[model samples]
Target chain A: MARKGRAGAALAIAAIGSFFAGTVSTILVAVFAPPLTAIALQFGSAEYFSLMIVGLISSIALAHGSVVKALGMVVLGLLLGLVGTDIYTGTPRFNLGILELSDGLNFVALAVGVFGIAEILRNLENEHDRDVTIKKVSNLLPTRQDWKEMTAPILRGTAIGSALGILPGGGAILASFASYTVEKRISNTPGEFGKGAVAGVAGPESANNAGAQTSFIPMLTLGIPANPVMALMIGAMIVQGIVPGPNVATEQPALFWGIIASMWIGNLMLILLNLPLIGLWVKLLTIPYYMLFPAIIAFCSIGVYSVNSNVFDLYAVAFFGLIGYGLAKLRCEPAPLLLGFVLGPLLEEHLRRAMIMSRGDPMTFLNRPISLVLLLLAAAVLVVVLLPSIRKKRDEVFVEE
Target chain B: MKSLSFSSRDLICGALFIFIGLFFAIQAYGLELGTALRMGPGYFPLVLAGILILLGIIVIIQGTQIEHEPMGPIAWRGLLFILPAPILFGLTVRGLGFVPSLFLTGMVAAFASTRMRPGTALWLVGGLTLFSVIVFSYALGLPFRRFGPWLGQ
Candidate 1:
């Protein structure tokens, strides 16, 4: 979306379509993923705890750069997450006499500070260098040939996304990446993969949308969130006094069905508004960093304040802004940290519960077959990351041969 | 010398990690830290802190041994303007109400950017203030006072 030039229109159209596709997929999974319903009832605390560890590891896989730095950031995020009043004891952990800090740091503040402000700070240094090309998007829709090329890839992507989306640690990101790999392997014009093939856009777009929607499976039915967005949704549900779990479907059918109805309506609105508003979005991109950033700051501040009409959240955002920038400078990506932050409390809760249930034996994690599998999966991911780098180092030595 | 150079960025990062870990670990020390079987609030935090401290050491080692790009100059101006703008809003929002506070926040932020002209800033602020009022107060019906208690309520 940030890149300029000729492929922009196709990318934009595909992205817009993907938005609606994502919405449809979410509803489909919510209604149809029966296995997820079963898993919700069956999962013990041990299994859930193991699953969270797997989610943490999988998120680590998503971060680029040194493992040590990424892991450190994840830990930092976890520690930050540990702030606020302990649920079990009702005593504040790191509030330090500040009454506002008792409820913990506002997530919106932290997110906006990290993602919005830190990003702007990074971009500001290169403000003079960035060339925002005002290229006219002459074509509004995909051509018939474009549609033909997209169809197969889209179907294949949707399939890939929908399947993976049901997994505990899986979501749109994994789906999109997996679909891209599959598309590249199966594509007839494999050479065109990187250089903006129609299938490239179509496949990932569909898959991303499908994955986004289907990833809600664990969130809605099972109560265990797959990602930070799902965690936010869970938080939203809680604020509305709805406990998100398997029983939610039967107990509050209106809320469940209302969510489904709203999602479809939102998709329809997005499809209608997006293209006509593309010009507006493009115009927004053309705004200079100096002007754009202040606006962002203003909006983020207002949004943070609106969360609880509190001023303390502003300080939290500022503090996190510096931390986020510092981590980014150290080549640590924030996504894994965000994921870790979202899942940290749950991980602690489940781990404690499982341990208590199993009489504190460390072997209980290994004793449970499901928990054992999850641990093995996490170990496998670590090895996969380690093995490839080792091979690449060896390959460098053999290049002359 | 350049080829064998270390990254101060990584060194600072390592130190930061260690510092944060140690801080938390020490704080948790006073708390009840039960065994892993029947863990206390302090136990999990201690474990995480230990992991962080270990990772920090590894990071420090890498920083001292490996060659990487020198850390670039910090955007101090952006940081100064961006960081304070929100604080200013928080301080003033309750006093001045949402619209004026928003305008002031926008103005302060606008001045942060050396490139933004005064006339453009004024126009932009005006537009934004209107938009925020409409969207937040009128459309969304958010609970912020338009005039505020400070103005002789």
Candidate 2:
């Protein structure tokens, strides 16, 4: 296996690039895509439902696990998503009789609980005193040859990131992950992947960064949020008395252009901040887990509690964190579950709309051209998963990294 | 070992899936499924649950058929500390406020590890609580209390 430190270093730096890159890109897409860049504006409910299904399929297919477990996780997520008040009927589905749950479980708290707090619990399983090498601070820069190899992957990653970022629910995380898989497959030395191949870092970093920037396209132009973050942005714009959608390009030209300018500035700031921060960030890895975990808990508790200033959110996080730990033990990856959770409401809404539009005709999904095409693509993904050669390749790519 | 023997991991996973799938399907069965076109709230969930149950049964069959890798012992230690830490924070946050709740949560969570020293845990709790209070309460201007309910915010 590749040494943990080396891989951690690469992922950490790449993560920093990705986090801001998304924020910047989302802000800029409005300015750059003059016409508001929404190819999916003509999307019908059938097409929208098909698109969400595609997302569900990709999330499961991309993750490493038995099909049953992954599907179960997705179903669980969807069920959880249905917990809030149903929009059409004004009836709460699964609020467990708690008034606090009327609006559904808080997304931020749930994410923090599952990904962050649960991760800490997992780490504590095999916890050991970390060996600190304080005296030997390694060179942060890649060698000359490293730069040469990284150039192509970075470009490829950027391109992929930009394209996928515009797709609803295909955010920076998916872009980076998909980029890494593609990079690993195309690399000359595939065996070097788990061992911290520089390309693994470079490709994903660039892709995630680019994806983060470009995902704003649908939000800016069509005003349909492609991801949860975009949903928040749309909410913010609405609150600020700015009506998003196609007319924003014509009515609010200056505001659109200004946001784009800020995206570039944000990117510049990220680069400046990252270089000096690298050393300090790496130093974090050397801290022993016991000291580290409590601190993580400290931050998580405060953060979860602060959201809506609701203590119930904290309880929700705790519950989810426990479930997360159980799922982790079962090797049911949570990433797909998370994506499913985020997309669940949309999926249901689209399905309901499509059904209503079609007057209960189940064949509508098959009949609609765009919806049929998306379903075909989803079918292709399933076929690819079942293929023995692709399965082997998936195994190779799905290692500890 | 033959490929047909039950694998512990797959069996547990399969059973869990089957149980959850059945639960949702049965519950939604009571609700109006409507026609496929009209699509009641229960329709989509019922369809998904059916698929899930089918997949679960497949996994169960696979479990019975295959020899599998051994499952790891679940870390009860980690679960004990990590699970309740947040609930404690929840119960206390409103009455005690952010600072004390976080500190207590951290201290309780610290013991999840057998290796944690009280001195280090104390320091960590203190340092993290202080930083968060300043950053979250002071810098962010969050309306939640640093100390409230008992102290009257």
Candidate 3:
């Protein structure tokens, strides 16, 4: 669209589609959250443990590359998550006499290292000058034909996004991909998709916005992060001394409602601001990657240091950056690892608590109906991913994107 | 029938997992392992380590069966320069203080790219340090010695 001098039209379509999707999905979240919270309130430790298992297993299914590699990453992440003073026993487990590590490795430092620093390093490997030629955006409004093309896709995308975003692990990314596939498959002008068909951009943009909005459902209701962004939000909540579980709705009604209200306002703000700021965004793309990365490293160091003013965390960032880069080179995805890290302590706590409650009978997982169903679901996911026919299909799907 | 060939990528990946798993397993063994109903700190990690090791073995076996892509070019220059930036910051932040330490960190990171000139790096780092001091120190009111004791501030 930009190459064809229709940048403004494309931008308008995306913004309008996203706004509509965001509004609808926010309403869905508001409607679904209370009931989900009520259901969550009834859950025991066994159910929670099974739920996390389902989450972890599904993460492996969704991760690109070898399933075994992804599983290994998850296990490695779980082990790394355990490196600190044992919560129950008060005996330090993996600190190796580093007093700074008694509180466990800082989550922010690890996240910045793995996702941020590693990505920077990867980009540096292929150093070529980026030549950006942005067309002057003139058509600020979409044509009537554009509206006719986009309406159905926007609605379908909203539905898909709202449903998938409630699932554990990274759903927004999946929702967008699914929406794009659906749009291309259903469109009469399928050949136009890669060439920027109206439905192509409209569907995935709407889907991703809706998915991002509704992903809050799992985070707010169960205190289980739906993605890494949600995990970061949970971290922020902990820092602010707010426990992020089912009780949050009742005890901190203001905060819960405030977050929901902010979603609507934020969507509105984006629509209002984005069109005018489009040129600025284009200009930002003109900045050389080389110049940008040094600033990123500096800011990352300062940000990590400012968290606790502990220099040890900064060292961890460097260490984990190398680890993350190494893992990337080995074709292991980091998403599963991060999710495992977040859920490790919680999963272990629930497992021990559930076992103690059941008097050491492992059958307790099978006996409890909710836990049994969740475990079965996890098993089903694992089995489906492992099936040779399904594995080939999965690879094809990823390759198509 | 084709002869079996192992993928070096998977072999290394599997070995790394196994090595880390064994490390954790040995450490967990040193801790007291209680019964299932009452798991000690070591029990859960020990189980996870075992699973990791098993998965590693599975990975190695799978490597022998499938043809794989060669591991591509590594960012050696990026690794040498980029990885040390944060460690350098950590080592000198308190001693050199935020201004000097951050400047040095940014300067080191800038050289990671072959495209960066020395003059450009100095300018970029200088500007970054100035901006950071203003935002992080003055506006945010984070309590850090802008100039640390080592600077006689």
Candidate 2 per-residue lDDT, tens place, A64-108, comes to 767557777777777777768776667666565789988877777
Query: Between prediction 1 and prediction 3, which has the larger TM-score?
Result: 3
TM-score of chain A of each: 0.88, 0.78, 0.95
What lDDT score belongs to each candidate, Candidate 1 first?
Answer: 0.76, 0.73, 0.88
- Evaluated on chain A only, model 1 obtains a TM-score of 0.88
Interface RMSD of 2: 1.5
Give one digit per residue, the lDDT tens place, for model 1 in A308-391. 888988888888888788778877787767767767777788888889899988788899898899889988866665576743
| B-chain TM-score of model 1 | 0.93
State which candidate has the highest DockQ: 3
**Model 2 misplacement above 4 A:** A1-38, A129-135, A141-153, A164-204, A215-263, B65-67, B151-153
Encode model 2's per-residue lDDT on B8-89: one tens digit a residue.
7777777888888888787677677677766666777787788778877887887776557766666689888888898898
**Top-scoring candidate (lDDT):** 3
Q: Give each candidate's fraction of reference contacts reproduced.
A: 0.67, 0.69, 0.86
TM-score between model 3 and native? 0.96
The collision pairs in model 1 are: A26-A213, A360-B37
